[model samples]
Target: MLVLTRRKHQSIMIGDDIEITIAAVEGDQVKLGINAPKHVEIHRKEVYLAIEEANREAVSDVARVDLKRIMGQLGGSE
Candidate 1:
């Protein structure tokens, strides 16, 4: 893990695009502002984990479904 100390208004660049700036510091909380392209996705750790778990559950549910039977029930033939 890369750790660095940044004062308010100070920023650090990731590559050529992403920039993470220290917006404010109040007591024990620190606010950050991130600047990145629209294509980049940024989510909190908990939210990301939840999304991953949901995706895993969806795949598991799909695996348990009989696709061929469903298609046949819908009057479709392979």
Candidate 2:
């Protein structure tokens, strides 16, 4: 993990475009502002986890095919 200390109003640039800035600090919580191109997606860790989990469930449901349904669609004996 690349950890650095940044005070309010200071920023760190990433690569050629992305920038992360410290907006405010209150006790143990901090607010940050990110600047990036519209094509780039920035997601919080928990949000990503939830999206991944939902995708996994959908994929698994599709993978668990009903053999009977397939045979009926094919007009073949089960």
Candidate 3:
């Protein structure tokens, strides 16, 4: 991992699109401000992991469902 020390208001750029700035430092906590395009997604690591896990579980459940049987029950054509 590439680690760099940045003081408050200092910024680091990623590629040509994203900018990560050190907004504030208070005791042990550091606040960051990120500037990026609207298409870019930003999430905390734990939140991202949870979303991935939930998606996996949803896919697994969907795989176990019988789509044909449900369609038949609804009187829909195959």
Candidate 4:
């Protein structure tokens, strides 16, 4: 992991697209301002993790379902 110290109003660039700026600092909390293209997705780490976990659970639930039995019940063409 790369660690860099930035003071308020300082900015960092990612590749040629994204920019992160320090907007404010108060006590131990720091506020950030981000600039990026609309196609780029940005999320807080915890929120991202939650989304990933939910996707995994959805996939697992689908895998556990008896699709063949449901198709038979619906009179699907075998």
TM-score of each: 0.82, 0.81, 0.83, 0.81
Worst 10 residues of 4 by lDDT: 63-72
Write the number of the candidate with greater lDDT, choosing between 1 and 2: 1
The global C-alpha lDDT for each of the candidates, from Candidate 1 onward, is: 0.93, 0.91, 0.94, 0.93
Q: Model 2, stretches more than 4 Å misplaced? A: 66-78
Q: Residues 1-72, candidate 4, lDDT per residue (tens digit)? A: 999999999999999999999999999899999999999989999999999999999988887686756877
Ranked candidates, highest TM-score first: 3, 1, 4, 2
Per-residue lDDT tens digits for candidate 2, residues 1-78, read 999989999999999999999999999999999999999989999999999999999887876666556767789653
> Candidate 1 on 1-78: residue-level lDDT in tens?
999989999999999999999999999999999999999999999999999999999988887686756877788543
Candidate 2's displacement at residue 20, Å, is 0.4
Please name the candidate that would achieve the greatest TM-score relative to the true structure: 3
- For model 3, the superposed segments whose C-alpha errors exceed 4 Å read 66-78
Tens-digit lDDT track for model 3 on 1-78?
A: 999999999999999999999999999999999999999999999999999999999988887686756877788653
Worst ten-residue run, lDDT, model 1?
69-78
